[model samples]
Each structure stands twice: as C-alpha cells, then as structure tokens.
Target chain A: MQIEAISKANSPEIACVVLCCRIFIKTASAEELEQFVQAHEMDWDEVYKYAAFHRVRPILYKVLDNCKIPAPVLGRFRNYCRALSVFAFERQVESARIQQVLGQQGIVVRMYKGLDFTKLVYGGDIGMREFTDMDMMIDSRQLPELAKVMTAEGYECSQIEYLRRFPEHYVANKKDICFYKRSPMGKLFGFEFHHRPGNFLMDQSIGFRELLGQDYLHHSAPFSQEQYYRLMLLNHGASDYFPNLRSLVDMALLSQKGIGSVPEQLRRVERLSQELSMRLLDGPAAATPADNVVMRCATRITKLQLTVTLRSVWERRYMHIRFSASFSDTFRMAMKFLHYLMLPNELDINGVQLFSFKLYYLAKMVRCVNFPGRFKKVFSRV
Target chain B: MTQHDIVHRNEKQFMISNLGNEIVLMDIQQGHYINVNPVGSVIWNKLAVPIMVKDLIHSLVEEYGVSTAQCEDDTLKFLQKLQQHHMLNVQ
Candidate 1:
C-alpha cells in the first residue's frame, strides 16, 4: 500500500500533528515542516490533546522541539517526553530481567512492539515510541511455567484464577494472559504473554511458531523482517482496529525497510488503514478518484466502528465478522462471539465455581434483555 | 569538596539518555529516574570526562553568561544533589 501526503482539509491542529509525524518518519522534509508551522495559526492545546489521544506525544515532541512552538507548550511537551522516557527505560529494564529469568527456566520468549520496535525502527530511542504493555510470544506449553515465574517476580496474572478453575475453557477462548506489576513510583506495567499471535478471530492455520520456523527457539533473530512486519500489521492494525496513529507510523517505518506484499486476506484492511493514515497524515493525491469513493465509504465505516460512544459488543462483533477472511471464518467468528456473550466467565460470577454454570447463563440472558433500557438511561445523559 | 575536586557522571550506576536539551537519568538499582533541566544537561554532558569544579564553573559561566559567583553556587548545589542520588563520582 502507498502512503500519500497529508490532506489540506484537516484542521490546523491535525495538520500540524500529521506534519510533525511525517517529519519524524522522514517522509516530509524539515523545511516543509517549518514552513507549514510558520504559516499556520496553531491551537497548541488542540495539538497537544490530539497528539496524546493518538499516543504520538513522543513523536510530536521529538519533531516539534526544533520548530518554533510557544515556550510553555514546548515545555509541556518536553516534560511529557521526559517522563515517558523514564517509563520506557524502566519497562526495558524490567522486561530484560523477566526475559533473563524466563530463559533460565527453559522457556523461550520473544519481545514485540514496544522496546523491540524502538530498537528496530527508532534506532534504540525509547522516548520516541510509546506502548501500553510488554508483549511477548511464547510457546503455549510453557504458559504454566511462565505463570509461576511471573508470580515469583511479584507480578499478578489477570487470568490465574480462571485458568486455575477451567484451564481448558480459558485456553480455548483466550489468546493471551496479562500480568501486571506496580513500580515503586506507583506506575503499573502490564506484561502480556501471547500463546498465539493475532486476534481471537484471526485464522490460526499457520501458527506464529511455524511462521518463525524451527530455529525460532534459539535464533537471535527469531522472525525474519517480512514475518515481523506481517505479524505487526495483522495483530496491531486489523486485530485492534488500528486504535491509534502510532500503528500507522510503525507500518510506515517498516515499509521503508521494503516489506513484501501483505497477505491476501489482510490486503483490504491494510489498504484502508494505510489510506486512513495518508488521508489524515499525508496529502490525498495518491488515491485515484475511483479509489477515493471506496475509501470514503470504508473510512466512514471504520470511524463508526472506532467511535467510543457508539461502540458496543454488537458493533465489535460486527467488525470481527466484517474483517474475517472467509465465509467460514465469518461463521466461526460469529459463533465464538456468541459463545463469549452467552457464557459467563469467572469475572461474571465473581470467581465462584458452580456445579452447572447454566444458572449464570440464565442471569446473563436477563441482563441482556434489560440492556436496552439501561443504555437508554445512559444515552439520554450523554 | 572545594573547587579543586574532579567529578564525572556515575555512568555505571545510571542509564542516561539525552532528550533534546534535557537529560533523563534512570537509577539502575532503584528503578527511579530524575529529569535534568537544560542547564543540568549541559553540566551532565560536560561531566562526560572528569573535570575540576573550577573548570566546570568556568565553562557554565561562559556558555550561560551567568555571574561566576552565581554559577559556582548553582553548579555546586546541582552536583551535591547528584551526589545525594549517587549519580556522581567525586575525586
């Protein structure tokens, strides 16, 4: 997919943000960036909020520090960047420690997305990228051992109780288990252990282990560059519905390294995400007239899917089915989602193990019936 | 310590990054970090190699155009804080 230039129709704040990110990714020249910044009457508050919302504050700070921003706004950006730098550094240290310990226990794990990509794309500058959790891929068989090691390291597993009570059900339904630990500074760090890559609805015919190959266990570079980019696009973009601009920046940077063609199943979503990024961040000349009409319709659908106020379980399930690879995949995903909704998990029952578990399902059905009235009350206030 | 003492960054004890004009120092043992302002960044960069307090003050006074007396006072206080955090090594 090709990334076009930022659209001129964007608000001043959005334009500045897009331009700043473009400069960071080296797609736009610094002189062009300076000219755009100087010509516009920018709303610094909006720029800050938009950057934060998109999880691109670090990139914004990095690119705009050289531009002629107001001193107070620059200071705010710098302060945030510095704080994130500290957090990223701490996450790196903690991750390395965890990896070392896990390695000693004969479990092989691979880091993804966060500091790993920071090293790969940002030249090891942690502050320029932000990630919510430390994502690592491990062999499914090693999960029990991994959990023990995590608990020993003062981490609390989110699914420990569930897994302990109904291991079979938990494994069948969940792709990853998250463990969290709080730092002395009171910041929480989440470490997600993925037994399989991609979302629950993603087709798992080719497992991550197979894609990474036999030497994955001990190879210094477990995934080839192509495989890494593909997994990122699928897991980060399509799976999570392209939650923020950071994912697009990641794709843009990876593409610069010359990624092969995206998988056939992922092409549409990848194109749409790339188009959205280009439409918002870059100019619009790359798309032909025919392509723009299709993109316009797709972009609206994506925006509606991403709209927080309108988001619901039904909307998410629709997205899952919409993005499914095949007719069979769609049916499978719909069935899985129905299973997820009808069945009450440990959280729903407050971890109480019942003899039948059917009683909880009945309660769930009653709650579903009352949901519309409850939603009406909440929606009225909004 | 007097102006004759030599000081340098405790590189072995902290993971440091130069973030634009500011500096971030993460204490490896403590898992906490300190943000050094632009002036502190200048001082930290200069301390890359061992230098005497008098020379450090001379460089700061020249670069920032501050009074020698004021630079010495502020630099000493900053260096003392680093020492308190164990982020500096004095000789």
Candidate 2:
C-alpha cells in the first residue's frame, strides 16, 4: 500500500520529461535560447519550475525561446547555464567533425546520443541534455590514426607522461584529448575527444569489438537508415540508460517512432540490461572466474519468465530508486530476481556472486526447449 | 567591518578561482565555496562558522604556512575587498 501510494504520487515517466527539460533549458545560450523562443511554444510556469531546480535549465529554455538574448554575464548565477550551453553546442559541432573524420578514414562512426539524444529524449519541446564532452568509439586499430588526425586538426593527444605521473584511476578507462584553444574565448570552449566509454572490462565486453556487428531484428524494420543506427540506439541505451528513468523515456520514444515490436525490443533490451547490470556490479577481477556461469545463466532466461523481475524494476517508488546507492545496484538486484523467477539453478563463478551458474543453465535449458534451433551453443569459449 | 580589522587568507579561497584560466568570483553562502582550477575544481568544505579576522589568518598560516604578519595584512585587505562586494560582514 505504501509503495502503491508513492508510485501513484511520482511517475517516473513524468520525472524523466521534467529532468530532460531541466537539462535542456539550463544549457542553452542566448543565441540558442532565442532559437527556442522562435521555434516553439512553452509552458513558462513549468519551464520556471525546471529552472528553479536545475540552474542551467531556465537559461536554456529562455535561449530556445529567444536566441537574440544577449549572452549573460559570466557570473555565478549564469555560469552553470553558460557552461551547459557551451558544452551542448560544442558537443554537436565536435560530433559533426568527428563524423567527417571517421568518414574520411573509411570508418562507419555511428553517432549515439549526439543531437538526436537532446532532441528526441528531451521531447523536442525543451532543450536537451548537455554534456561536456563528445563520446565516439572507433576500431581499436584506428586509435593511432585517429589520434594523429585529431592532433593535426588542433586537438592535442592526452599526454601519457602526465597521466603516469598523476595516475588517476578514472582516466584509465577512457582515452581523451584536451584540444587546447587558440583564442581567449575559444580557450574557455576547449573540447574532449573520448575513445573509450567507461571501465576497461566494460570496454572489452561491450566495446566495438564485442558488438555483434551481426544484424539483429531491427534489420527487417523499415527506416531511412540501416541496421547500424538501431544497434547504436540499443547499445547506447543498454550501456547508459537503465539506471535513469530519463534514458528509459528516450528508449520508449525510440521504440514508439521506430517501426518495430515494442515488447520484443524491450525483451532484447532486458537481456542487454541484465548483462550490463552484471558487468557493472561484478568487478572485473571478481567476475573473471564466474564469467562462464553468468553467461550461461544469462543465455537461459526467457522474457516470459521475467514477469516478477519487470514488476520489481518498473514498479518501485521514486524515493527507493533515487536513493539507491547507485544505478547499477538497483538494476542488478532486479535482474538477478528475474533470472531466478524464470528457471532456477545453482550457478558457480569466482566473481559472479549474484546468480549461480546452475540457475543460468536451467534458464538456458528452458530457452533451448522453446527455440530448439536458435539456442545454439554455450559461450564458454570466449 | 572596519578595513583595519579585516584580514584575508590567500591560501585558496573557493569563492574566487579560475574560469578558463581567468580568476572569477563565485557566490558564497555560509560554508561552501568552489575554486575552479584548470583541470577541474578544488572544493573547500566545512568552513568554520562566524569566520573572524584572527581565525582566518590562523587558518591561512596553518594551511599555507604564510608569515602571521603578512597573513594578517593580506587577510585584512582581502576581507575589505569581500566586504565591499557584500560577500562577508562583521555582524
């Protein structure tokens, strides 16, 4: 009853929309805010509420409403908004440039969460998410050449010597660049070029290499673009969106617009979600020995078997979800329960403590029974 | 706050730091202040309440090891500047 009361009060979907609006308006520049004013009609009261909560959201809302607004002074009040707008505009510009660079290098550099993330996820009615850097992953072998091209184009490569001396553990996962500026203002608007996503193990598992470039169901669906775009959306959402309701909203939007079975897409998304949760919660060293068990279990679970899992993940109140230690923790628990509800087994693996491999094997057996031909083989080799 | 009674601590004020390499003043509340460095930020937390001239000078000396005499003078000057800008008061 308590859970029901809380759930009825705060809708995750509404929160997602409001958060998107907050991010969008908080980041728009005078020029951009002016564009917003001309381009769309907004509920000023709601925009004001968002601005109150998130510092930059209102400025962005204003900018979108009136692009002609003079740039606010770089004081404390306007700093956040200014920073956000600068970050948004820079990401868009850099993503375009990175796309061109990748094109020249014969790389099919798929853009995930660039302009579309802001436009579609934020409901196009408000400003979109603002990020300080643009993330674009390329073929690992292309790292050297990509670095060279970036350097030639005025972006400086991250100095290994400094990293070694400083030894920041966070930097190890993502390869990046400062791209020093030439002008005074340009100096404020420096850029970051990211080669990797987050953690090393994560990079290895979901990296471009791990990505089953092999086509999925989205291939048959009719769209202006080909299979790669759909995969990009799935990968991005699977990698980043699960913990936050906002991301799920984006996924929902994509599911609505794109011609496909929403439930089926969600089912596949559920699988990816499980895998992501396992990877994030189980550290690399801890997960190494248990990889087989986890993989085996993951392969076994069916969508229908995960009814309780979905109920738990989608059913919770905001306070419970928001205050949960981290996003990964919440998803992992929900997924593990889903795994058990399907087919139970005692799975074994060194780092895979959450679900026993035996349980996974049982789920796999159920899947094998349903889709005899497609169940294929165990992934113990990898 | 009298200019003579004022004292400034130059060790590092989170309230005024760098923005793209240029130092800029930040809004100050009761306790929190953030100094934006080139790389990112250095946030100073849990500032002593009712910050006094002598206390700030002592803090600067203990934190940065500046001479007490110079610390007091500098702190005074900085406090005056903050007072002018309505950031701090003698209440």
**What number of clashing residue pairs does each candidate have, in the order they appear?**
4, 38
Best by TM-score: 1
For each candidate, what is the lDDT? Answer: 0.73, 0.39
Interface RMSD of 1: 1.7
Model 1 lDDT on a 0 to 1 scale: 0.73
Query: Each prediction's DockQ?
Result: 0.39, 0.02
RMSD of 2: 20.9
On the 0 to 100 scale, the lDDT of residue A62 in model 1 is 77
lDDT of 1 at A209: 58
- What digit string (tens of lDDT, one per residue) describes model 2 on residues A171-241? 44334534544432363334444444432212233433223243321233322222333444444433333
Tens-place lDDT digits, model 1, residues B1-91: 7899999988787776667778787888887778898889889889989999999999989998999999999999999998999988999
DockQ of 2: 0.02
Pick the DockQ winner.
1
Residues A134-166, model 1: lDDT tens digits: 998887778777888899989997677766665
